[model samples]
Target chain A: MKSLLTQPIFSFFVTIGLFYFFKIIYTKYPFALLNPVMLSVITLILYLKSFQIPYEEYFEGAKVISFFLGPAVVALAVPLHEQMVEIKKRKSPLLISVGVASIIGVLAAAGIAHALGASSEVVASIAPKSVTAPIAMGIAQKINGIPSLTTAIVIATGILGAVLGPGFLRLCGIKDPLAFGFAMGSASHGIGTARALEEGELQGSVAGLAMALNGVATATVTPFLIKLFF
Target chain B: MIESLFFLFCFLILGEFISTLLTLPIPGSVIGMVLLTVALEFNIVKAETVKPSSKILLNNLSLLFIPPGVGLMVYFNIINEYFLPIVISYFVSTFAVLYISGIIVQRLDRS
Candidate 1:
């Protein structure tokens, strides 16, 4: 049984099967903490570690899925296209808000991490944690951070934002759907957008726009921002 | 389907080329995304050419994240050591972005 499961194909099957499996559970429960990414990552890690399987072995099958992340990043252009009318009508405000958030997102995370002595690489990694994983990984590499660690922190940041962002916004008396969406996308990326979609259409599209825009904004700003922290 | 992916890959490669040429801090995938958006806007690449493929990838974007997330296992010790700093920064930064961005957009949007 152990040998059968270690086959490269098993990793592929298990990853996809586990993700959708948790996704189904999320749909049924709709609990923020029950995020599919978090659940799937935890279960897969336990599986790999307990069985003494190396990450490289698991990655062999998984890399095929991972390669799609690149094309998917490009594909994000499509949603930005679909949301153009909304993005255009409110262009300046949307751009301004995302710009400010992008800066704060980096400074706040990296600043706190630095002050607490998270080491050079951790500071750099956490700086781009709020951006989507693909873009965040890229920014991490250029900024002298660990790309893989950035990937994990990016996912964790998304789950944190999805679970808490809405409630936090409401507590602050933010009622507009666009505000909610922009906050979610800029702070949490795609996972936050998924949670935004459950609220309404306006929130969903705006969040998608924010996610794409924040990726660019954060990538552009990080090189400059790290100077302040480092 | 193949056509959509083919066009997307072209843009992806183009993005990497530009990033390398200019020494931009941004990633090739990001540069590619921006180029793709512009191309679609200018009618250089028909929107229909990429829509279907984009849909499938976007729908499973989280799935694409798993392989890397799984790699987090290797860094478990580091994450454990810096747990407090990581947690504090995660909460504080995420909420800061959320509250401030939401308010900024709201006030500026209405005006």
Candidate 2:
């Protein structure tokens, strides 16, 4: 009973501690596969498995983290608001980029899934995997995709994009902060936008723009794609 | 802090109810976000009340997924069963977005 009562507190601190630890390792090694979020999650999962801790117990505190997701999403408006003028100026191009990218992303994922003979459900799950969770889950639920599966896929994609996007941009000779930022946001969503912010203000600002546009585009287009493809 | 949490809670529930009634394609939390965004846009909700809690929440957003991802344990043994398809889908789709959108953004930048 004492352990049960203290579980939430323990889990919360464990998460924080693990994150900082992973950050330290990430700084030293800088491996793409050892992304902070990825490493932290793997660490937590391993801890749980080794201890044979039940998920419900672990989630007691973790769900507290989720309760904040709504506000976190709302907070995204801050960066978006700060970048409003530039976003307004390039609204047309931004919309086009997001719309085209989102559609192509869906088709490419779905196409490959079909080619690989993936179950229809797996195809649907991947369809919205690039979008953030709430939207990804919505897309999944709509098209008979597995919502849980989509959530996992979405997080992995976000982390990967956040970690690798900047390096990829540099490799491609794209140095414009706005371009780099927007590309990351459009391709990766919030996680990528967060990473872009770390790169610089200009990158962060434009990345925020991309994140907002991507969300809107994915939400609007997901339903349409489900109909057209399936 | 507690009051702000309650306000967000009520707002989320309200957003869920409205979206559900309309059978909107958007998810409840997203609708909640849009609602809050609009409220902020119109000055209905003061930033002071909203910003504090939102920051705390947003800063730790990545942590939220850990619990869900742990569910992967159930399918650990069969992970490879779907490995090829998931990998192919993830890469192809991601690359598609990158290539096509990259071109469009480049063109727009030129213009």
Give one digit per residue, the lDDT tens place, for model 2 in A1-230. Answer: 54853488887888778877887898799876777777787788888888888777888877776666665555555455555666677677767888888888887887788788888888888888777776778788888988878877777677778777777766776666666778887777767766676676556657656665676688778778877876
lDDT by residue (tens digit), candidate 2, B30-102: 5565666567667787656766666566555556555655555654543467899888788667655655565
Give Cα distance to truth, residue A217, candidate 2, Å: 3.0
The runs of at least 3 residues in candidate 2 whose Cα sits more than 4 Å from the true structure, single-residue gaps closed, are: A1-6, A27-34, A201-209, A223-230, B1-17, B35-60, B74-79
Q: Looking at model 1 chain A, report the run of 10 residues with the lowest lDDT sum.
A: A196-205
Error of 1 at B94 (Å): 1.3
Best model number under TM-score: 1
Cα-based lDDT for every prediction: 0.85, 0.70
User: In candidate 2 chain A, where is summed lDDT lowest over 10 consecutive residues?
Assistant: A73-82
Instruction: Give the 10-residue window scoring lowest on summed lDDT in candidate 2 chain B.
Output: B70-79
DockQ per candidate, 2 decimals: 0.65, 0.44
- What's the CA error at residue A28 for candidate 1, in Å? 1.8
